[model samples]
Target: MSHAGLFISFEGIDGSGKSTQARLLADHLRGLGHDVVLTREPGGSPGAEEIRALVLQGDPDRWSARTEILLFTAARRDHLERTIQPALEAGKIVICDRFADSTRMYQGLSRGDLRAMVDDLHRLMIGMEPDLTVLIDMDPTKGLSRALARQTVEERFEDFGEELQQAMRTGFLALADEFAERFVTIDGGRGIDEVAADVQQVVSTRLPS
Candidate 1:
């Protein structure tokens, strides 16, 4: 947890409803008058957005795991420098949709050699990370169904089939097990109000009180 201001992040497999839940939580906090900066990874910065497109383009079958990992890292570097750092420095509560943890799950867990990449990033660029990370845990199949129902394949990762996405979800859980200090998994298979309430409670209890 952060010593002073709140710096929280949300993580999940694609279609885990992180963005929706993040918005709900941020809205709840703002209702209480806290300054909140709600944003997403692979974006939230000009440079990162470009990298995001590159990372998410084409068919999932055509993309390599190493390539996915590197693209994620590149986008993260831009986001940290351009969006996250500035907001945290201003003492604002930042609720990022995803952070380095996504890379850990997607690249390291799914692909290979996650430790080396994660350590390098921690050592090189990222200094202060999220005070708390909310992992929206759900069946990847269910999530993929929901996501696909809404969109028409905008990117590569988004195009991954349900089985592969389920594997990705397991990877995310492995990250939570290893880094329990910062990761809090929430059941996102519940009703929207229930999920939002859980997120709100987690933030209120964890944030400065």
Candidate 2:
């Protein structure tokens, strides 16, 4: 919708190096003559940070499915209003580690309606979508191994067993396929630098001159 700035999102299962790659890409973008802002979902703005803690504290039983989605959507609304929108309006490229796609993958696992809810929330809150979304792909077994290896703190999802984690991986890949045009699934099994290079290539090729 006539944005001079670009919105790029990185998505994947935990430990797929989305955060690291997001940072790397942001840095690379800034180096290549772009004003860049790096942020994450459920924790970008102050209000969202509080929601993030409650969401990750493993209190699923305390939250109904609708409640969980609503909390995430509320956090997203605040983040877009307070952080992302201003950055974009200022003509800064916004590279987000996770966005509405995470809600679809995490909350919509069993409840299909949750995906619709998240889509509606995204449209209402952000009023836009990423120009390109990169989904870092890795086997869940390997991803969890990496996740556990890097874990200083465990979130609710990190505690899930192989089965559920694998399902989540499947969900991400399915989404990549579903939104093929906006989605690019990178091979996250490679070394970090190698993956970073691949991501840089994608960014350099797409970024506006």
* lDDT tens per residue, model 2, 13-83: 87899999999998888887789999998789999999988887764365666777888888988888888
Model 2 lDDT-worst window of ten: 152-161
Per-residue lDDT for 54 in model 2? 83
Candidate 2: segments with Cα more than 4 A from true spot: 59-62, 110-113
- After superposition, the stretches of candidate 1 with alpha carbons farther than 4 Å from their true spots are 1-4, 61-63, 113-115
Model 1, residue pairs in steric clash: none
How accurate locally is residue 88 in candidate 2, as Cα lDDT from 0 to 100? Answer: 78
Clashing pairs in 2: none
Q: Candidate 1 residues 61-150, lDDT tens each?
A: 665767676677778778887878777777789899988878766776666666577657755766566888999998888898888777
C-alpha local distance difference test of each model? 0.80, 0.83
Lowest-sum lDDT 10-residue window in model 1: 151-160
Which candidate has the highest lDDT of all?
2
